[model samples]
Target: MAAQPSSSVFLETYGCQMNVLDSELVQGQLVALGYSICQTPQEADVVLINTCSVRQLSEEKVWSQLGRLGIQKRRRKELIIGVLGCMAERVGATFFDRMPHVDLVCGPANLDRLPGLLDNARRNRGMQLSLAGHTSRRSATLSRAQDGVESLDLSRASSPIDHEQGVPAYVRITRGCNKFCAFCIVPYVRGPELHRPPAQIVDEVRRLVDQGAKEVTLIGQTVNHYVYA
Candidate 1:
C-alpha cells in the first residue's frame, strides 16, 4: 500500500514571549497530530498566525500577512488559514467578516480546542471558532479545574531540537491580568488573571529540564502577581 502523505503547517507568531510559547504549544499539538512544520505558508496545507493586539503596528503586520494569505487562499482553495492569540480574542467573529479567507479563529484561552477546530474546518471547509468571551464568568477554582489551559501546558512536548539550539524555554505561570490600566488591552483580551497550579508549573519545568533545556523563563501578563490559593 502507498504511504499516506504527511500534512504540513506554516505557523507565524507575533507579539510577546507568551505568544511565542503559545505557538510552540500549538506546533507541538499539530506535530503530535502528524503535521510537519514548514518554513513557508506556500509550502504548507495549513497556515496559522498567532497574533498580538497590544499595538497598532502589531495588528497592521497581521493585516499585511492576512492579505498575503488571502491571495494564497485564492490560488490554493484547500489551504487552511487560522488566526490565533490575543488578536483572535479581541476581534472575535469580526475576523471572518474582515478576512474572509481565514478558516479558523481561536483565542489563547481556547487553545485546547484548536485541534478539533482545525479538524472541523478542514473537513467542513467552513469557519471554525473558539473564543473566551463571556464564558470566563465561572469561579476561579471552577475555571482552573475546567479550563483546558493547564492540561495544554502539561501536555507540551519539550523539543530536543530547541534544546540543541539553546533556545530558552518558556513556562506560563499565569494567564491574563487583573490590573485594568487605561492604556492596556491585556485584561480585556486575555481575561482575568488565573494562576496555574504550582504543581503543574513544577512538572512542566521538570519535563523541560529532563529534555535538556538550559534556560527556562516564567511568563504571564502580570507575572509578579501570580499566587495560588
Candidate 2:
C-alpha cells in the first residue's frame, strides 16, 4: 500500500447521482485546498460523510456510520469528522449536539463552508487540551439566493476524478424540490428548487470533457421542472 500523505481526506456518499456529484465537487475543492483523497477512513486526516434522508432507513444507516466514526474519533482527538448533504440540513445544529465527535455539520448548500471549517479544526486541534465537551459549532445559515430559491453554491471548476479516465459523470444542474408530496422528504431536506446558471453548467461540462469525461448525466429531483432560460 502507498504511504498516506500529510493532509488527506476520506469522503463517503450515500444515495442519488446528485450526492455522488456533490462528493466529486467537494473532493475537487478540497484538492485545490491541498488535501488528497485517501482510500480508507484510517488513512485520512479528515473524514466526511455526505448523508441522505430520502427514507428513514437511509438516515438510520447514516446514524450507524456516525457511531462507527465516533469510535475512531475517540482514539484520535485531532481527526476531523463531518456530516454533509440532505441529512445534515434535516437535522441542522442538533447533529452537533447529538454527535459530539463531529467537527462540522453542514448542508449541501453550505459546502462552501467546509474549507474554513476544516482549517479551524486543524488550528484548534492542538490548542485545546481536551475536546471532551466540544462539538461542531457550525449553524445552518441560508445566505445566498437566486430567483427567491436558495442556491446550493457548488464549485463550477470541480471536474470528476474518474478512475477509468473516461467514464460518465453526473452534473447537478438543479437542486432541491418544490413539490412536497405526502410520502416524500426531498422538499423538506433539500428545500425549494434552485437551478444552476446555464453558463456555469456549460463551463463545467466543457471542463469535464477536457478532463476526458465521455458522457454526462444532469441530475435533479424534479428534472422535468428545470427552466434555465
Candidate 3:
C-alpha cells in the first residue's frame, strides 16, 4: 500500500442511503487502490458525485452539483470528475450532452468496473467509457465488483453510515425493468428487467453483512416480478 495521503478525496453523495452505500463502496475500493478520504472538496484531487434519479427534481440536484464541480475541474486539471448510480444509466450518453463537463458517467449496474473506468476516464476524458458496456447490452450477469464481499460493513465505512433499520443496505439486486408502467419511464429508459444470478445475489448480501450493514434491500423498480432464466 502507498503512503496514506495527508490530503485526499472529496466524495459528495446525493439521493438515498443506497447512494451513500455506493459511495462507501467506492471509498473502500479506492482504499484498496491507495486513496485516502478528504473532508472538503476544496482539498481533494478527485470529486465523485454519486447521484440518483428516482425523480426529476433529484436529477436536477445531480446536475447542480456537477455544475459546481465543473468550476473545480477548471481550477484543478488533475481533479477527476465522475458520476455514479441511477442518473447515469437512466440518461445514458445523453448526460454528456447536458453536462459535457463530467469526465465519467456510470450507471447503477456498472459499479464494479468503476476503478478501471475511473482510470480510463482520467486518461481519456469520456462518459460512455466509464458507465456502459461493462455488463454488455444483452448480458444479464452481475458485476465483478459484487464478487467476494458478502455485504457492506456499515461500521467499517470511513463515512457516516445511515443506520436505517429495515431499509436494506443499498444493493442493486437486479437491473433494468420489463414493465412499462404508465406513470414511470424506467422500463423505456433503462430497458427490460434482467435479474442477476441467484447465488450472486446471496453473495452480495453476505458482502453487505461483512460491511456492517444489518439489513439489505433488493433493488429494481418492479423487483417483485423479477426472475432469471
Candidate 4:
C-alpha cells in the first residue's frame, strides 16, 4: 500500500506559562498523530492558536490574531485554521460566526477530541466547534460536567516531541484554579484545580531534559497550592 502523506501543524501560543505548556501538550499529541511541527503557517496543513483570556488585552489579542489568520485561511483554501485552549471555550460556537474561516474551535478540555473534530471538519467541508469537552456521539450534545480543563497526566509513554530544543521549557505540573479571587477569571475559564501525579511530573521533567531542554519551569495558576497525592 502507498504511504499516506504526513500532515504539518503550525501552533502559535499566547499568554502565561500555562499557555506555553498547553501548546507543548498540543504539539506532543499532534506529533503522535503523524503530524510534523511546522515553523510557519504557510507551510502547515493545520494552524492552531492556543489563546488566553486572563485579561481584556489578552482577549483582544486573541480576536485580532483570529482576524489575521482568517485572512490567511482565505488565501489557502485547504488550510485548516483552529483555535484552542481558553479562548475557544470562552467564545464557544460564536467563534465560527465571527471568523467563518476557522475550521476547528477546540478547548483545552477537549484536546483529546481534536482528531475526530478535524476528521468531521474535512468530511463536512465546514467548521467543527467542540468547546464542550466530551460530546455524546449519539445525542451530539455536550456534557456540562465534562467541560472542565483536562490536566496533564504523566503515566503515558511520550513520543520524541521536541518543542524548545536546548532552551528553557514550561512544564505544567498542575492545572485550573480553585480560589477565584475577585479580580481573577481563571476559575471560570480553567475550571477546578487539579494536581498532576508526582511520578508523571518527574517523568515529564526527565523527558524534557532528554529533549535538550536546559531548564524546566513548573507552572500552574497557584504553584504554591499544588497538592500531589
Candidate 5:
C-alpha cells in the first residue's frame, strides 16, 4: 500500500498583533487537521499569507509577497495559496485581478471555515473567498487574547524562524465594534462589539500554550473595556 503524503503549510503574515494572532488561530486549526507548518513558501503544499488593511503601504507589501507567490504557483500548480484575516475582509481578491493565481480568500470571520474553503478552491482551481464576517454574537467575547495584541508593521518581514512556531498566539475574545473613528473602518465593516466570555478566553489561552505558544494578545477596539462581571 502506498503511504499518503502529509500536507506542509507556510503562513506569511504582515500587520498587528491581532493579525499575528489571527495567523496562529489559522495555524492551530490547520494543524488540528493534519497539516505540518513549513518554513518557506517554496517548501509548502499550502501557503497562507495573512494581511492587514490599516495602511496603504501594508497593502503594497502584501501584494508584493503575493507577487512572489504567484510565481511559485506558476511552477507548482498544486500549491494552495490563501489570503486570510483583515486584508481578506478589506480587499477580497481584487488585488488578484492582475494576480489571477490566488487559490483562496479566507477573510477574518471565515477563518474557521478554512478547510472547507480550501477544498472548494482546489476543486474549482479558482478563487475561494469569504470576507462576510461571522454571524455569531460569540464573535465579541471570543477575544484572541485578552492580555493584548499588537498592530501590524508593513516595513519588516518575518523570517521563517519567526514563524517557525509562530509568535504570541492570538485568542479572539470579541468581535465587531461600535467605534467608527473617522478615517477608519471598524463599525462600518465589523458592526457592534460581540464578546465570547472569560471562560472561553482562558480555554483558548491554555490551548495556545499547550501548542508551544508563550504569549497571547486580546483583539478588539478598546479591548481594555472588556468586563468579566
Candidate 6:
C-alpha cells in the first residue's frame, strides 16, 4: 500500500443500516490506509457523503451538501470531495457532469476500489468513478466468487462504540435484492441479491462480539431472502 499523504477525512452517511455498515467499512479501509477521521467537513482534506436514492429528499440533501462543498473547494483547491453508496450507483457519471466539484463517485458494490480512487483523485486532480452498471447483471454465483467488495466487510477494523448507544454494529448477510417491485429502484441500482457464506456470517458476528460490540444488527435489503448452498 502506498503511504497516504497525511490527511483527514470526514464521511457523512445518509441512508439505512446497510449504508451505515458500508460507511463504517469504508472508514475502516481509509483509516487502515492512514487517513484520520474528522467530525466535520470543514476540518478535512477529504470529504465523502454516503448517500441514499430510495427517497428524493435524501438525494436532494446530498446535492445541497455538494453545493456547500463546491464553495469550499473554491477556497481550498486541494480538497477532495466524493459521493458513495446507492446514489452514486444510480446517478453514475452524471454526478461528475452535474456536480463538477465531486472528485470521486463510487457505487455501493464498487466500494473496494474507493481507496485507490481517492488516491488517484487527490494526486491527479481528476474525476474518478466506480459504478455497478452492466457488472450488476452478472450471475450471483459469479459475483460471489469474484466480488472484491466482500473484502470491505471481511477486513473491518475495531468497532467504535457509540457514546450513547453503546457498541452497536451492523453485519450484512446479503446484498441487493431480487424483488422488482414497481416503485423500487433497489433492484436496478444495488443489483441482484448475493448472499455471503454462512460461515463468514457467523465468523463476522463472533468477531464483532469480541470487539466490544454490545449490540449487533443483521442487515440486508431483503434479509429473509438470504440463502446459501
Model 5 clash tally, residue pairs: 29
**In terms of TM-score, how similar is model 4 to the real structure?**
0.81
Query: Could you give the candidate ranking by TM-score, starting with the highest?
Result: 6, 1, 2, 4, 5, 3
CA error at residue 70 for candidate 1, angstroms: 0.8
Clashing pairs in 2: none
CA displacement after TM-score superposition, residue 175 of candidate 5 (Å)? 3.0
Q: Ten consecutive residues with minimal summed lDDT in candidate 4?
A: 134-143
Clashing pairs in 4: none
Sort the candidates on lDDT, descending order: 6, 1, 2, 4, 5, 3
Error of 4 at 58 (Å): 2.3
Cα displacement (Å) at residue 221, model 5: 2.9
Off by over 4 Å in 1: 1-4, 142-144, 158-161
lDDT of 1 at 119: 80
Instruction: Please give, for residues 137-228, the per-residue lDDT of candidate 1 as tens digits.
Output: 42465354587766667766733136646678899998888788999998888888788878888988998888778999999898999888
Task: Give the alpha carbon lDDT tens digit for every residue of 24-113 in model 2.
Answer: 878877786668888899988899899998878889998998889999988987788888888887777677678877777777766766
- Best by the lDDT measure: 6
Number of backbone collisions per candidate: 0, 0, 20, 0, 29, 0
Cα deviation at 207, candidate 5, in Å, is 5.4
> What is the C-alpha lDDT profile of model 6 across 1-229, one tens digit per residue?
5536668999999989998888888888788778888999999999999999999999999999999999999999999999999999999899988989899999998898998898899788579988889567345763445777787888765323342355688888898888989999998888998888888889988887777678888999999998887
Q: Over the stretch 26-134, how does candidate 5's per-residue lDDT look in tens digits?
A: 6756665667787888888888888777777988998898889888888988888888877777676685676788878866655667777776776675678776654
Question: CA lDDT of each candidate?
Answer: 0.84, 0.71, 0.64, 0.70, 0.65, 0.85
How far in Å is the alpha carbon of 140 misplaced in model 1? 2.0
Q: What TM-scores do the predictions have?
A: 0.93, 0.81, 0.69, 0.81, 0.75, 0.93
